[model samples]
Target: MAYSEKVIEHYTNPRNVGSFAKGEDNVGTGVVGAPECGDVMKLQLKINPENGVIEDAKFKTFGCGSAIASSSYVTELVKGKHIEEAMTIKNTVIVKELNLPPVKIHCSVLAEDAIKAAITDWKSHQTPASAQEPRKAQES
Candidate 1:
């Protein structure tokens, strides 16, 4: 199957392709595998605890170009975004952004899942008191 230009670019020069040390207080990691294609993806984020913003992101994906592109693009999307804001990212956005074809949709889904999983892992590390605190109200 043919790949989109964005996919090609990402596959050739993926962004943030590395890992953070485990057990870092500010780092969260998510690992997921696609049973259908035997593909695996690991995504990690370094978050700013005080403001809940993602300061950096990294990903390693073993799959087709679509999967690599999806992971790469998502890392970029999550950077500089608040945890809550990053959680809203959907697979459709990845599909659109990478011009992923129908069969490659699962790659985008994997990316979305990775984002949520990482966020969940990060939240799990938060102190109960801090986790329980009410979030700042969003201005309309």
Candidate 2:
């Protein structure tokens, strides 16, 4: 399959290609695998607790060029964005941005899934009372 120029650029020079220490408190990690193609990706985000903003991102992907490009692009997209805003990034946007063909759509889906998974993991680690107090107060 022919990749678009942007995809090639990202694939060739992927950004944030490393990992944080396992116990790093501010880091959130998401790992996803695509059984259809046996592709695996691990994505991580370092969030600012006070503002819920992503201060940094990293990824390791074992997949096709499209998958690598998708993950790389997503990391860049989410940096400096609030976690909720980052969650709004859809697979369609990745596909459009990467100019991925129909066959490569799944790669974009994996990227989106990875983002949500990381966010979920991050939320899970947060103190329940602290995480929920704002919402509870709003509802009451």
Model 1, 17: alpha-carbon shift in Å? 0.2
What's the lDDT for all of these models?
A: 0.92, 0.91
TM-score of 1: 0.90
Q: Give a tens-digit lDDT track for model 2, residues 1-140.
A: 78999999999999999998875667888999999999999999999888999999999999999999999999999999999999889999999999999999999999999999999878866776645544334224
For residue 11, model 1's alpha carbon misses the true position, in angstroms, by 0.2
lDDT of 1 at 41: 98
Stretches > 4 Å off in candidate 1: 128-140
Candidate 1 weakest ten by summed lDDT: 131-140
**Per-structure clash totals for the candidates:** 0, 0
In model 2, how many backbone clashes occur? 0
Model 2 clash pairs are none
For residues 1-140, could you state the per-residue lDDT of candidate 1 as single tens digits? 89999999999999999999866778888999999999999999999999999999999999989999999999999999999999999999999999999999999999999999999878876777645543222111
